[model samples]
Target: MSLSDCRILELPRISDPRGNLTFIESDNHIPFGIDRVYYLYDVPGGAERGGHAHKQLHQLIIAASGSFSVMLDDGTERRTFFLNRSNYGLYICPMIWRELHDFSSGSVCMVLASRKYEEEDYYRDYAEFQEAAEKRG
Candidate 1:
């Protein structure tokens, strides 16, 4: 899919004077069914992660604790999203390259994936990802 397919989603939030709560339901708040869930935390300063693309996986990435930036590339164009709110998330479509960087200390990145982890589904090489994206087009 193209870069236009990617979007930001606002999750349900319940505001309380004591604290706030955010929740997501499969195929309700997200476009796809949830098959796997993962999170990244305690990332050291200046470290980067997620330098790859998935062939058939859809992901909803949220900043559950602190802040971080998600750089997205769809073979032709590139964009960056800064995530710091628990009520917001970035929806990444398949066949796009993504990188997570500039993670603040104690940042927790929660990822809701549409499918289980499959090594074969990942394209880690930028050139290979571009070629694969071209083939998909």
Candidate 2:
């Protein structure tokens, strides 16, 4: 998929006097089925995560608490998305390189993925990802 396939998705939310609640359903809130779920937390200041691209995985990343920024690179162009709200998610398609950075203190980045862990599905090198993107382009 291209960078154009990446977008921000708003999730369903309910507000009450005490607190707010958010929920996501597979293939309803996101474009794919949920196969894995994970989160990043307690990230030290200036620490960065996700310097890779998935060959076939689709993902929805949400800032469950606090804030962070996601930088997407699609061989020829780049875009940065700032995420702070709990009810919004960033949907990422396959073959796009993503880097998560500028995380606020105690931030939690929750990810709902379309595929389970598969080391062969990852492009951990930017140069390799770029090369593959170019060939596919």
Candidate 3:
């Protein structure tokens, strides 16, 4: 509903002399159950993605490698989050418009979604998203 509703979550980290490890479990490390998992990679410089909002979907976005920023707008407020760590993730709620941009080379953006992909659940147009957000509010 608002930018305040979005939060950065810290995942479990296991440090070892060999290598550091991070793990995430559905509804354990994230607020919602994970029904889908995907990642974005090989993004060219200055390119952008995710210019839409979901009606009832929730997602946890993490930077598994390199770095990137997510711009979030919740109808009334806007905020930007820089994700560069595999042990941290950004939790996005429904009705919030999100855009992913400013990706560094070799950046891997991983997303854990609450539900499987459905075209009807997406609000791709900003104007329509604003109207839907207003109605929900």
Candidate 4:
């Protein structure tokens, strides 16, 4: 996939004076079926997460609380998205490199994955990921 395949998906939100509620449904709101769910929180300031690409995973990354930036790189192009809203998710297709940084205090990043975590599906090396991405194109 290419960087153009990545985009922000706005979740359904219900606003109220008491509180706000938002929700996501697998295959109903997202483009893929959800197989795993996780989140990142309590990150030390300036600490970065995600410096790899998935070989065959579709992911929807949401800023559950606070704010942060997500950098996505394909073999050919790069884009950065600032995520601060709980109701907006960045949908990342397969074969794209991702890095999360510039986290505000108390930021919580939630992720919905299309597959269970598998060690072999990850491309931790940028050069290797680039080479594979080139081949995929």
Candidate 5:
């Protein structure tokens, strides 16, 4: 749940004269099994996303196009990462407070989640997240 627990996964890049390709598969580059894939788009400046934390699900986030950044906080520790390439990803463990920001124009962020959509699995407030994380200790 700390910044130290988060990791950057360098995905394999297949270079071609025309273009480059990258991919992430379950039981491979991703630490957790992938069950869902979603992308964020059309984010204007001064807007933010992912102001929440999951209780159990893990996520592998990629900047599929353009660039973006994520601010990670685990109640005590904080770290920020700029994701600007398609061949890289950020692996976020459970109980980490994450906020996605600074999206470049036409940027698209893809997230591979370990679990399907479950409202109960989400902690939408920092105070609530802290309480749950504390209880887990």
Candidate 6:
């Protein structure tokens, strides 16, 4: 598709003095749907997570506690995003290689996914991911 097709995902925010809250709903906040929730935490500075690509999963990632960045690549194009606020999220589409890096200390990244954990869904090898993405075109 186009770059616009893989842009950031807009999420709903609720503010209160007690605290703020954000929600991600299946087929609602997300387009495809949702089935999984995972969080990454305690990553040191200059460290990274997620160096793979998914076959058919969509995700909405948020900085629930602190801040982090997501670097997305689609073989031909790339984008870097900073998620610092709890009320915001980054929606990542499938077939895109993503690297979640640059985590500030105490950062908690919550990911809402559209697919369950399937071993076949992951492309752990970069060379394999590139070949598969090219084949899809």
Give the TM-scores of the predictions, in the order they appear. 0.98, 0.98, 0.98, 0.98, 0.96, 0.91
Per-candidate local distance difference test: 0.96, 0.97, 0.94, 0.97, 0.90, 0.83
Candidate 4 residue pairs that clash: none
| Model 4 CA deviation exceeding 4 Å by range | none
Evaluated at residue 44, the lDDT of candidate 4 is 100
Backbone clash pairs for candidate 5 read none
- Which parts of model 1 are misplaced by more than 4 Å? none
Name the better of 1 and 6 by TM-score. Answer: 1
Ranked by lDDT, the better of candidates 4 and 6 is 4
Q: Model 6 — which ten-residue stretch has the worst lDDT? A: 1-10
Question: Model 3, 12: alpha-carbon shift in Å?
Answer: 0.4
Q: For residues 1-137, what per-residue lDDT tens digits would candidate 6 score against the true structure?
A: 42346766667878799976777668877786777889998898898899998888888888888888888888677889999988778878888899998899899999888888999999999999888888886
Error of 2 at 125 (Å): 0.8
Worst 10-residue lDDT window for candidate 2 reads 21-30
lDDT, candidate 2, 73-97, per-residue tens: 9999999999999999999999999
Candidate 3 residue pairs that clash: none
Model 1, span 46-85: residue lDDT tens = 9999999999999999999999999999999999999999
Candidate 6: stretches off by over 4 Å: 1-3
Instruction: Estimate the TM-score for candidate 4.
Output: 0.98
List, residue by residue over 76-132, the lDDT tens digit for candidate 5.
788999999899999999999999999998999999999999999999989999887
lDDT, model 3, position 68 = 98
